[model samples]
Target: MTRVKQQKPAASPAPAPSIPAIPKPDVPARLAALPGLPIGELKAEWRRLFATEPPPYNRRFLESRLAYRIQELAYGGLRPETIARLDALGEQFDGRNITFRRIRHEQRPIAGTRLIREYQGVEHVVTVTRDGYEWQGRPYRSLSAIARAITGTRWNGWTFFGIRPRSGA
Candidate 1:
């Protein structure tokens, strides 16, 4: 009677597989390829800006764009009409597309007027600097320079382009 019941063996559980940790960003690409500014100057300013969060005028955008725009303004200046157009656009960049790197701080700075341009395809981040000017930061000094970096190719994001008035007035 004791041996009447048949015993069943338990199934073994599967072992968990290991996952890899996130890789660190390539410092060279991050530091080397600036849109229009000199490498040394950009490095110095990037160091200064990164330590602190985006100031008033930069706060509106995500951390990366805000950081990027600060670099842009150091090289190029924005245009007055562009600023007016942005206001008129009121969150619209032409009828079909729109993006923003807005001022999101305790007190936004008055840019007076800042130019906006589409370099590769995306909206180039533009902003006014403390010394009073606009700037752009994308594409690096050369496409080769950008290619040598992590992307292994040219970056197609916005760049600091010269201001051109909208025609057909």
Candidate 2:
């Protein structure tokens, strides 16, 4: 019986070496390096982290947001309750809540604080009260009213008093 030579089974390929994962740097180290990174590098980082194109905002904005994002990723995002609370608060300001009235609480000067202004070489003092402002022994509902009383023309009370309006008001 002529038996055909049986071919030996091909040797299996050796398993590839397992490369160890490169450990991520600590959060603080990553954050500390943000300011020094070039803009291109920052954008690259943003793309890698967000998996999208970086915004067209300025460098400072990118840095600040990236810093926050880095920390957020390292730890965790806002709690669900906190996010819900923020969304509800946002709804109040976005005109979605029909009964919501914009309260100028932050715009109002603290009660009992004295505001002094000089117009036409005369010094005027106004006291901030809980309900309104007091000027020359008269309660005024708004600083504009007080300013109008001081200056014969309509003027922005904050501008007249050199009080810069709070940003994002």
Weakest ten-residue segment in model 1 by summed lDDT: 97-106
Each model's lDDT comes to: 0.41, 0.80
Give the TM-score of each candidate. 0.21, 0.46
lDDT of 1 by residue, 71-159 (tens): 44344336889888777766453333222222222122345444455435645444544323343444232222332343355643222
Candidate 2 stretches greater than 4 Å from native: 1-25, 97-163, 167-169
lDDT of 1 at 92: 55
Which regions of candidate 1 fall more than 4 Å away from where they truly are?
1-47, 50-63, 91-169
Model 2 Cα lDDT, one tens digit per residue, 27-98: 879889999999999999888777678999999999999888887777777999999999888776645632
Q: Which candidate gets the maximum TM-score versus the true structure?
A: 2
